[model samples]
Structures are given as C-alpha cells and as structure tokens.
Target: MAAYLYESSVEPHAMPGNATASAGRVGDTSPNTLGAFCESPGQPYDGLPCAADSSTCEDRAQECHGRGPLFDKDLAASGELGGYGFASNREVGRRQVAGVREAMGLQGGKGGMRPVRSAHAYVDMGGYEFALANGTRVRTCPAAMGAFSFAGGTTDGPGAFDFVQGDNKTEGEQNPFWELVKVFITPPPSKEQAACQAPKPILLNRGFAHKPYEWAPSTVDVQMFRVGNLVMVIVPGEPTTMAGRRLREAVHARLVSSGIFDEQDDETHVVIVGTANTYTHYATTREEYAVQRYEGASTLFGPHTLEAYIDKYTSMVPFLANGVQGPDWERPQPPSDAPPKEQILKAISMQTDVKFDAAPFRKQFGQALEDVQSEPYRAGETVWARFVGANPRNNLLLEGTFLAVERLDAAGTWVMVKSDSHPSTVYRWQRESTILGTSSVRISWTIGSDTPAGTYRLRYFGDSKSLGGKISAFVGTSGNFTVG
Candidate 1:
C-alpha cells in the first residue's frame, strides 16, 4: 500500500504551480528557464569554473556567464573524482548493486518466502516513516536537513536521536552528502553537520582541518534492499538522472564485466521510481538534457539523474528476471568479495530473534495471530512476521524485510560471503499449498563455528509486482500466519 501525505494542497507535478508569478511575464522570461537557472551560473566552489559569487541571478549574468568555463575546467581537472565520465556515477551505482547481489548469495532450500525488496523516490523532501505490521517502526531522512536544500525547520530538536537525523543548513564549503556517507559506510562518531542555526561543530576535535571540494559526499542516496522480506538500507546522496545513472551503470557494467547475468534474463533487471523516499531530483533523456534547458541542465540532476532514469526504464526487470516464477526465484552467484550464505542467513535469523528482558511477545500477540498481524514486531524472541494491508503512498499492501548483520570482514570492509552462498530464500504460494492464501517452505541451516550465539533473522525479500517492478515495494501486512 502506498500513502502520500503532502504538506501542502498542491500536488506533485512536472511544472511549478506558482511559476507564472515567481517567473517574469511570459515574454519577459520563464521563472526557472535555461537562461535563468541553467545558463546562469550557480554557487561557485573554490576551484570549479564559475564566476565569483555565482550563487545568485546577478552572479549568473555578470561574472558567471563568462567565467563559468572555470567550473567546467574544474570538472575536467578532477576527472573521475568529481563523478564524471561514462564510467563515473552510473558505473558506480551499477557496481554497488552488483556488489550487493554478489554479496547476498541466496541460501536455504527455496521453499519459503524471503524478504527482498527495493525502495525508490524521486525525492524524499519531507522524509518518511514506516511501521511493519510486525510493529517494526523505521524512520529515515537525509542525514542533514536545512532551510536552503532540505527545507525543514532546522535543529534536530530536543528529542533528536543523533546527527544521523539532524538538519544541515551550512551553505557553501559544507558537504552534507560526504558527511552523511562517511557516517553511513564508515565507522561511528561521524561528525555532526555544521548546524544551520547556531552553526557550530559538535564534539569535533580532529587535529587537522580540510578544504571543501566539489566531490561526491559520503552520503550518496539511501537505498532499501530486500531479499524476500529481509531489508537493508543504503542511503547515498540524491542521484541526478545522468549523475546517478553512473551508479546504476556501475552495477550493470560490473554484471556484464563479471558475467553474472550472461546466461540469465538480462532484460529482467530493471529500475523504477515514484515511491517511498523522494530524495533525488529531475530525470531527463540524454537528448532531453542536451537541449541545455532548465530541467535538462540542472546541475543537481545533471550529475545524478542517471539513477532515476534507470529506475524508470528498468522497472520491469526484477519481476521478469527475479520475481516469483515456477514457485520461486533464485539469487545469482556471489562475487569474490561476497559473504558466505550461511553467515548471511544466520545474521538474518538473529535480527528476527531479537530478545527482550521482559515479556515482549505476550504484550504483542495478545490473542489471535491476526491481532498481531496488523502491527509491526515489538522486540521479541521468535521469528515473527507482519504484513500491512496498505502503504501511505499507494494504500496497497506494503511488504519488506529487516534484519541484522552478524559479522563484517576482519578488516571490517565489505561483507564476507561463503562458498556457494546466498543471503536469504524466497517462496511463493502454489495451487497445492496449505498455508492459507500464502506459500510455504522449509529451510535447514547450520550456524558456523564463527557465529556468535545471539539473535539472528531470516527475511523474505519484498518486491512490488506493480509499476514495471523496477521499484521496491513498501513494508506492510496483508494477512496473518499460523506456523503449520
């Protein structure tokens, strides 16, 4: 189910509703036309080819119009570091996905539902929240928000959990993307953003300081990945269509280079948009952007739009290539860097096996399994499942999976996969199945000697059967379960 609670009465549209007034008279000029927004220079970085103070209209016309070449020069100078080239953003995105799929090798004899799903958004302007029927409530947003970019009341507020959810308002020389990314992929104690309000460093005592560059920040965009119902979140910076396309291409290029999809359904892998989070921006065709118009020339989207395009164009891939067919779907082979299948499943099981000091299950179950089916999982110690009948955006059945990671590589780099490994298993209902309207499966697992005795989880990846299947479905419950 998809539900959308707009902050304003205005709906999401291609063109701005208040454009006429905000923009000059029709003949005078468009509000955000190529001449105004694109051709006009924008905020200049220290060495990017741009006019001094290119952040405003005045700068665009006076200094930027002529000096803008400097910005292009900077891009050329930085080369791959600036997220440029055919092998840049698109290549990176594609590689990341391939790496994830390679990392999550399927396991368990394929007869049960697995937690696997993906989430897409044109932009996550106001952020969003989700509560699985199991009572698992997860809230996500850009690492930082502010008056200029994210446009929410500044300050993480008194109840702020951590800088992970705070607002970033520092203009110029501050890279919110990098800050969030560092916190995401790397270790903890990620520095708090330069606060928009008081704008001061928090708990930062680094011995050295660094200069800002027009480089991709650590916080790329946040991606929701699922294998059956098990879900993991990878939030990166907003992907511009072409810009983000590099990331997507990166994955595909790897698959092609690594020969993962050669014998399988190459046409089946796809991308989709318009759901869950709306964190990125405009997406145009290569021909479209070449026009050098407003939408086409948007720097934000220009560098990142490829990801969105992939989402739109490839929406049907998972369903055709990986969705349930002949009763189940199988994950492809793992890369040399992937984790072991046993380890992945064990970790997934542990996430589901969350323990509680008190009686968590009694309070949740109450009576019938149906009663517990409508809510998310409270902290407990059983392999529990919840299904929501609707989503906030589409009001359709919402489904997803979440679990924990048991072990990282010794270097703590990427996940370590075992020989012939896959992370989770997926199952679909057949005409002869007996689990009510659902399908069923049985899995046999052996905890590795290296596995620490703790809570683990097993999840079924969630995938939307709608909208071309490029986008990942939301998490919710459609029915209850009685272990037979």
Candidate 2:
C-alpha cells in the first residue's frame, strides 16, 4: 500500500490600521542572508559531524541533513506536529514574512514608479560561443552532469550508496566501476568534450543522448522585466549566490551604460528570478565550478556558463530602454531562436493513473473516523481529526484547499480562518488496505499564540472515485472545540 501526506501552514493576518500604499520601491537582497545550515549526523549519528568536503558521516551521505532555526525544539512538547524539518521550515517562513512586512512598511508611495517594460528571446546554449570582456573567446559545452552530480545528492535530500559531494575526480582518479559502466548509460564524452568540461569529469553527457527524446534542454528563454529603476533577470536555471550577484551587478551596469536608467540620479536595482522559463539546471561561478560541488556539477554547461549568461543578458539591456527616445520610440528586435516545441510535446510520464477509490465496508467517503477532543485547547496546543478519504490524486483541487480550520464567529457562522496552506496545519494520508482500497486522512492545526479565543472545527474536503468510474465530492467536519 502507498500513502501520501500534504502539510501546510496558517496564513498570517495583516495588522489592523496598516493601510496599503499605492507605490513602493523594490530592492535586491542577497540569497545567502538567511542564517541556516545543513546539520550533519542527523538522527542515527546525532553527535557526529559529516566530513567537511563530502558532507558524509562514516562515509554515508544519508547522515547529513539540513536543519532550520528551531531544530532544537521538540514538536510534541511544543504541541506542534511534523517530522524533523517542520519546525525549522516554520521558523524560516516566519523570518521571511517578517522581512517582507518590514519592506512593505518602508514603502514611499507610487510617485516615482516607472512604466513597465520587458524583453524576451530564445538562445540555443549548446556550443554557444561568445567573447568575455577581456576579449578571450569562450564557448559553453553541451549539457552534461559531472561525477559530483552522483555524489549522493545534496544535504537537503541525501542519496544512498558510497557517493559523496565535491568529488571532482579526473577520469583516471574516478571509481573503476563507474568508469566501466558510464558508457552504457550515456555516450562517453568525446576528447574535445572532455577537455571542454576540464575538471568536471562528465558522468552523463545528456546533450549527446537523444534516443526516445531529448535528455536536456538545448535552447532556453532569456527574459527580463523592468519597472522604473528595478530590473528582474529571469534565469532559466538555479544560480548560486555568487553567480546571482555577478549577474545582477553586470545587468545593473549595463542598464546604466545603456542609458535605460540614469547613473547620476536614479538608483538601479537588479534581482535574479531563477528557474523561470525552462529547467537547464544550476549555474555556478567559475571558482565554484572548479570545486565541482552539487550545484557546480549540475551546471549543465562548462565553467563559462555564468559568463555566457551575463554576456547574453547585458547584450539585451538596450531593448529594455523606454523606446529609442520617448514613448513613441520602438524597441529593438530580440535575438531569434526556435523553442524546443518538439521536446515539450514529446515529454513522457511514468506515473500511473488512479484506477479507482473505495472506502471500507459500512463506511462512506469523508465520514469522520476520529473526532477532535471535547475539552478546550489553549494557545500552542494542537487540534486534530481523522476522516475516511479517497485518493487525493483523483483531483489536484488547484486554487482550492482540501482542509480548512473554521472559527465560530459572533454571527453564528463558521468563518474559514485557516486552510491547508497555513504553516500551523498538517494533512497526513495513510492507506489502511490496498486490496480493499481503504484510506484515511488526518488534519491537525496548532493554535498560534495570537489566535483569538473561540470555538473552532476541522473540516476536510475530498473527491472519491467509484467502481463504475464516477467521481463525487464530499465534506467532513469534526465536533466543535473551544480555544481559550
């Protein structure tokens, strides 16, 4: 039997008397500003630290785990529900919300806001050649994953086996087993290709592998959006901190030099929006690429990837100018390249369809199996209920929630104060019997300190499929409980 769980949090309400501003300034912040790190020797190896370079403890990558700010907090003792990482996730989200609120408060109104402008183009990155600022000719190789890519993944999601991160070994230094077997998986990198990806030690030459369909993207979207002095660089892949900084700085300088923004009076802001139009993989700085860490190994292209991106983005800056002179001026034409429409249309999925859903004998879908406690709950306490459920995969419920926390208002009406999207709530699913097709869902909400005293109930919404292939929606609500 297979089971699924979905966790969400309660939304934070805005403070009363804080009116919305018409305009505000957008600024860029370093992605590394958050104070958090992956903690090694998690759980089984609790007191030990992973090896510095490989992020492994006792030669096992599974021991390394990412920890949040509240990693030390006991979930049960604190009346919260979730696994090891939930507490930290909650704390990180809270910090981000606080930061956004502060930025909102610093808004100066919409008086100085500029008109919205945008630029877009498609570029084929495979063997893309360009010259650096120093006039040194460079070219990005076809998409390929390096040896470190199989280094047991990253700390966030550790992989099994003997692989570890930062493994930028040369062909001669690599494992003999992998060296012998890699040719069977994908074509071995050619001599020129091997030299192009110098220190990477190619593990998967995806660019050359095109059998059933394309393995990696060859063409990617280069897009940018501008509103007044702020520019958003839409990146096709995840960029490391240093790579993002370098790209932003280069774009900002280009905007100034291209006269899109005045250097003397206007302050230009550039931010990187990653994983925008397509998934090319990760982009890392040259130095980081040399280290061949997880991000660098997954860079797809060679060490010149970031430089190529910077070159492309800056070259398009003039297109973002507010016309050639005034509003009547026309923008320049963008670089032309065909998108990978065939690759998208031919995409395949291995996921199986949900044949049907069936509840236990004498039970109905959405029927309450376990109700909430009758006693009153206090701040920081958790309230939960379980219900007979169906396969959630039947319907994604896009823009809709499967669980909600309703409060009894003064008018005798149930008002939804929280949904599955909230951080304080968790929805867990378990399959009791696969042959019988019986399943259950548990919904829990941990009351926040700021939650007002009132009567509340947990409500679950679901869709079930019948033997005849008909689908129906249902709702289940638990007994009302008081919060004091």
Candidate 3:
C-alpha cells in the first residue's frame, strides 16, 4: 500500500530520549514530566554572528558586510555575511539517517534496528556583536529558521518535479519566492531592521531575527524530572538529533553514576524532548550552526547553544540522581508571545461578495463537473470526483468534514472509510476563476492493494460563496458503485 511504503521509507530510527517509529494507536492522553532537560542560557546570542566568512564573498562581493569597501575586521568578528544579506543563510539541516541508510544499501527506516547510533557535538560560545547599516553596533540572540528549502520554494524553483535539493553556497536572496516569503515572515535587515531598532530583529519568529527587550531571561532554563529510572529533559525549541543524542548520553551517564540506577539495569531510560516547556528557540552543536543551514540560521541562543544545555543539565543532574526531590526547576512553556491581532488576516480576504455568474461554459459553484466513473472497480484502482467550489477559507472543514470515501455497510448504511488525511487520499484545490471567486475541489482515492471489496462512493461537502452577501453550504455525491 502507498501508505505502508511512505511510512516504511521514513520511519525514524531509535533516537535518544524518545523513540520515533511505526505508526500505531491514536488518541492517547499525555503523561506528566517523567524527566526533563533544564538549561538557563548565559549570554543571549553570543554565537549568533558569523563565526567565519566566505573567501569568495570577501573578494567579490560589492559593499559586503554592512556598507563596506571590503576589509572590515568586524566582518569575521560579527559573522555578518554580505552579498547574500543574511549573516548566515543555509538550507534546511541535513537528515543523515535516510541518506546514509540508502548510501550503504540498507533499507530506509531501519536505522533504529542497529545499535550505537551517530552522535553529534553541541557547543556555545560567549556572545556575539555585529555592526549595523549606520555603523552602530548591536547584539542579538543568535538564531535562524526556514533557510532556502529544498524541493523548491513556495513559488520559485520547479513545482512538483523539483529535484534540486538546495545549497548553502547559492545566494537565496536571488530566489523569486524569497520576496514572497519575506512578505509573510517580514524578516529584518536593510529596510525594517533599520527603521525599527529597539529589540534585535531576531525576537520576531521571522527566521534569524532578534531577542526582544521583554524576553523573560537571557539564560535558557535547563529542566529535568525523574519518575523512577525514567528521566525526561525538556528543551525549549526544537533541538537537532545530534544535540538530542549528546544530551541523552550526558543525562543517562549521570543516572548511572549517581546510583539512580545500575549501569546494567535495562529499566533505566532518558529522553530529550524539544519545544517541551519554555521556548528559547533552537539548539544545535556549534558545528551544525557553522553550516548556516535553516537549522543553524534558526538556532537562537548562540553557537554554544547546545553547550548551554549540556552544562546546565549536567550540573542539575544531582536533583534526580537517586534521592533528590522537590520541584525547584522551571518546566517547558506554552506559547504566550501571541502575535498582535492586526498581524492575523481574517477569512474575508479570501472571500468576495461576487455571485457565481457563470460566463459561457463554466460549472456553477458547488456543482459537480464530473461524477464518479461507473465502477466494477478492482483493488488498486483510482477513483475521484470534481465539484465546483469557493475559497476553502470560507469553511476550513476543520474538526468537521470535507470529502469522504464511504462504503455501503451490511446494515445498508454508508460507513466512512477514508478522509483527506488518509495516505491514499488526495485533496486538490484549484482557483478556476479568481475574479469570479469561483474554485473547484477534487477529492480522490487511490485504492490500495489491500482495499476491501465493497460498494463505495465519493462525497464532497462545501460552502458555496454567494453574490447576495452570504455563504451557503452544499454537498455533492458520487452515487453508489461497487469495488472489489
């Protein structure tokens, strides 16, 4: 089945702290903190600046490193890269599991089966300083996010067939989609960065920006809790795999040495959970940040980001060693930095008062352009239906329903078999006429090899945009047919 192939191809190996593997049961409540990773960041963004420079940019870039005629010692010291604009601009961080697995002729998603997984280094320097456009110096919380994505950007690059995996050497500012992302992210540097200078731009989540003046603290809180031999380290933002591995090792070693558990005790376990509690941003080994990929660029604390956690967690280990107790540490945080109301766009932006004035040969809103093909369908066959639609924003279909693949049950009632999220199902939306606010929705199911024989049908539910200043809901059905 396509679902099985997709899962088997990407299942993660046993990662330290928590294991990510096979898809199993759903709908489970979370347990309390069994253990935690507690760290308080010392210096804010010490490693945020450019730790190194590209020789090519130094020699070739015009006005590189903040309005320079070249040769500013500050360039290397600040890590402020020019020509490309951002201090560090790397694509998404690497996932060595699948790549390495394929290279060695091993099946994908089997890395966890092998013991002694790879380990990565975590580091943090003191602090960083860089010069601004007006020659004034400023400090920032070292961080980065969403680098030039591989498999094409939102609008630029080849659409679905994009094979270019992306590169750090290439300048992303040249990307056509880069401007579009900026519109949404509103990244600092140049225009707005200069216009507003209170807190560094990194404070905003708009990738590699700033540490706001109102931040709770510069030190990231390293937290931990142990229930029996199970220990959990709660990390702020997303930590890379290598960072997770090192943290797990450090914590597990302490659990054994401190007499919390015997080295041979198979029951002892430690896990590193990210974005678990309070949010400081990302933690990458200094090596990872040095690459300036999306992960490094998004790493906020500083290069020594991982070091900050290791040092703190190592020191705080005694609390959960064997007998240590009491809640004397900070826990993971919920999102409180909710953006202002104005920043969020409402649904009306996507909706128009225009009625469905069908020009010439067009299907009306919510009308089925084509019904499901008559079926004596075999397993592995594909089925779909097309219907007239309005902008989905008019009705998000969240928690509710959109399209469904149903089978006639023994009781003669139609029992739902699949929805859009099913691996075999695809929901395609198209703007047939943006001006008329007319759109189309296509729901499809690729019958898998294991699909059971049945009388099945496709159903589409939509909210039609109206011309009389109201939106109305409608449904279209494929009518029943047999599949075996």
* Strongest candidate by lDDT: 2
Q: Candidate 3, overall lDDT?
A: 0.49
Candidate 3 or 2, higher TM-score: 2
Residues 349-416 of candidate 2: C-alpha lDDT, one tens digit per residue: 79977777888889888888999998999998889999999888888887789999999999999999
The residue-level lDDT of candidate 1 at 296 comes to 32
What's the C-alpha lDDT at position 224 in model 2?
Answer: 89
* Per-model C-alpha RMSD: 26.1, 5.4, 16.2
Candidate 3 per-residue lDDT, tens place, 433-454, comes to: 7665667788877786877787
Candidate 1 stretches greater than 4 Å from native: 1-33, 37-55, 59-142, 146-191, 195-238, 257-260, 263-484
Residue 194 local lDDT, model 2: 89
Candidate 3 — which residues are off by over 4 angstroms?
1-227, 275-281, 291-294, 318-364, 467-469
After aligning candidate 1 to the native by TM-score, how far in Å is the CA of 103 from where it should be?
Answer: 34
The reply for model 2, stretches above 4 Å from the true place, is 1-45, 74-79, 107-113, 325-330
Please write out the lDDT profile of model 1 over residues 1-484, one tens digit for every residue. 0011111113432111231111001111111111212233344332233321222232222222222112342246433223222223333334344544553465543457644444432333122233432666433222221212221111111111122112223333345655554444323223332221123222221111122221112123334343532222232322234433444454454334444344354342323222223323333344433432333322132322343333332332243233333432244321112221222222322232111111123321111122223332222112233322111122112332221222233464433221112122112212212222122222112233344433333322232223232334332222321221
Least accurate 10 contiguous residues by lDDT in model 3 = 24-33
For candidate 1, give the lDDT of residue 249. 53
TM-score attained by model 1: 0.22
- Superpose all Cα atoms of candidate 3 onto the true structure and report the RMSD in Å to 1 decimal: 16.2
